[model samples]
Target: MSSSAILDAHQTAQALPYLALTQEIEALLQDPTVAVPPRIVQALHGGGSLFVMPAADARVAITKLISFIPTNAQRGLPTIQGDIVVFDVQTGQRIGLLDGPTVTARRTAAVSLLAAQHLAPRRDGPMLIVGAGVQGRAHLEAFHEGLGVQEFWIASRSASSADALVAHARSLGLQAQRVDDPNAALADCPWVVSATPAQEVVLSAPPHSDAFVAAVGAFTPRMVEWSAPVCQHLARTGTLVVDTRDADHEAGDLLQAGIDVAALPTLADVVGQTARWQNAHRPQGGPVFFKSCGWGGWDLAAARCMAQGIAVSSAPQG
Candidate 1:
């Protein structure tokens, strides 16, 4: 049995602030020694899956064990539930366990925000978010806090979910409204985040050039939020960047569009050359599409962020 301190969802989120999480993720991206093995998925008996994702670096290592069950929604339970186990590299001791769902939601949003900070043409306009689920809420907070975004336009298949998300956004003292059609709103909202399950296309129309769209919903080849033509158009005229190489196979929008993933740039590549790319290359590009499939490196970054916060709070002050 491991004697690791367990942090509940709220506590886990308190530790990994959006700003800090982005910093840690960017740091890990730049570190050549960090290693994130591809996630392993095991199908369960009842139409579910068990995911084992691991990532490590010189100082720490983390493994996120999670189970996803679609029927959990009917039971009023979270679809994804588990814990991220963190260990110290030198001591080889289990230091802490964080709420897995919270880490996943926050880290994924942070990754998008990190990319958006670099890719967005302008940050002051209303941001459009398709899907009003956990990722949508997380992305809202990340962009509002990280980039000072004040207005939001939300669209979802479920009207109640969209209204709920809009209310949540307004409660944060931000301006938020519901849009019946996400595609129509794309022209006005330069910053867009598509966080749906990606069963079908949620954003089909071609967005304006210089817009930044972070497609975070579709991870599998079968799931897609953007229409094939939209993806093809973006690939043709705009700049397309993915979160990781794994996206080459997992990002549905890119793969189904027959995009040459190897020919596109990764977020790490953009971050490494932010100045040069933004100045010289971005101007020549049309819209910017950033497709983020799940990555274990992000989970590891969240764990490290949480650990750093714990260390800071526990330190003896003079």
Candidate 2:
């Protein structure tokens, strides 16, 4: 029997490539036969997040637990870190262990890009990103690789941080600029993405007539990223798409900002192509918004792709 292989964080990181992983995930989502359940996400005290994601399709079952500890910053650790363990459905055997952060960041950004591809206006435009952390950088990379973004405007509370992110983007051959004012950045860019973790609003509604906004922060019931005016504007003019219907209802940003939860379409609806009706019902050429509370199915799909080489075998009988 083949021996089971163990993969450490660094090894897992070396195994997975962000752009290729994201492309594979996008293809899996486009397929109609995949079975991915709604993710279970919990918020712990002191700014932590725990998520359980499971996917099964008769042959195999993959589940991953991802935790985020924002307080780890004080310890000189990552704000987001975790692990992924895969299992074979038939024999209940452990098949693989993967780096959670790599999977999480890549899959999350891929999902956002998928949303953008399906919902955002079909044109090359400037993208304004309002965060300088891991998620923000992931969004920049994914957008550049997956979409036709011509320019990038980075905004953060710290100008230096924004400049650093812009420099990183420029290193990748993207036309990037650091902006002092997020609103000004939004006003100039037709596509805006909010990736911050603020408990309050960080950006006002952009006045652009054809802007598309992708808000991926604020997973917990206590956190929010957009103000009331922004939420209202999205509700009135744009179509709001979420990873799940339940997540849309539970998001504090939408609830606290007074945006009706019923107004958004589920990710399944969009993937299944049922959202065309919702789009047809909405007015033409308005701003479109998409918010995701994160989904596990995406993580499982990506991890399964990354676990291709590791050997899996039955354990010896006790």
Candidate 3:
């Protein structure tokens, strides 16, 4: 229809342009009353996966379809390629379409940092990041701008990728450097983000007890970014917050660690079922970690925000 809108990658990215947008998304996600339920997630037989997610409330409704192809990176394309379709709640009409990967990259990092706000202590220390890719840069911006990280240390298997990220960070006015020893870097940094797509272990050691680790990659049962020891450490010392309850089944980090995922809590539990999820913690205050395999609710929220931005911008100017 003439009234409908289509948003490209730049416009979609502009929707989540700041930390404040992410803060709103976090609040929405943590609210158990939001009722953004599970969607269809199944692995692809040909080395990828398909995700169909529907997120809605009284005001707006939308669905996102994402396909993950890890090899896309070598093809000079984004690993996540998809689209989000918006629908009018009152009329059930298709209203808008947006670039899915942009919404995802922006929101994923924001969501991870949102968990950090509740699970870890605030500090101005340096932040260490693994995998200097899309998620890595997004996390770096969130930490330096939102979390007040003083410096940044990047580690990656690709020297050029890591160097490029460091330069990008520095250009953003953040103090960034490449590190060879991630273990040592993690020890000094209070905030750590592992954003790689590695199938095997990437972090050899966990940061200190006060450190906040955001395991941002490895969505499949085969791809695990956190090591067994690192996961076990998270299981023993503190509560492991997840993006959704589905992590009980989808998180490779927990499965690799052999941790009983049934005992863990989703970020939604912060609002809905805190008695069991929060009260169980013994207050040892050891290093807390949040593993985000990601979920459709997140995609829905982000896409909705972008759609709203488009609506507001298209309104007749005064």
Best by TM-score: 1
TM-score of 2: 0.85
**What does candidate 3's lDDT look like per residue over 1-318, in tens digits?**
246678798877767765766766765765454556777877888687888888886656788898988888888988988998887777787878878887788888888867777667657688889999889988888777777775899999889999999999889888889998787788788788999987678787878778888887977566798788878877777667777877877788877789877677777665455776667555767777887887777776775576667778888999
Model 1 accuracy (lDDT, Cα)? 0.88
Best by lDDT: 1
- Candidate 1's displacement at residue 161, Å, is 0.8
Candidate 1 is scored at a TM of 0.94
**Candidate lDDT values, in order:** 0.88, 0.72, 0.78
What's model 3's lDDT at 43?
Answer: 83
With a 3 Å backbone cut-off (N, CA, C), the pairs that clash in candidate 1 are none
- lDDT for each residue of candidate 2 in 1-318, tens digit (9 for 90 to 100): 123445676676555555566666666666655677777778789868787878764444677777778667557677777777777666777767777877777777877887777777655678989988778888888888778575899998768778988999999988999887888667668788788866578877553667777788777667788887777777777666776665755677788877666656776677667754366436577777777777666766766566553422233445
lDDT (10s digit) by residue, model 1, range 20-117: 99999999889988999889988899877799999999888999999978668668888789999999888899989999999999999999999998
Candidate 3 wrong stretches, greater than 4 Å? 30-37, 271-273, 314-318
Instruction: Work out the TM-score per prediction.
Output: 0.94, 0.85, 0.92
The residue ranges of model 2 lying beyond 4 angstroms of the native Cα positions read: 1-45, 275-283, 308-318
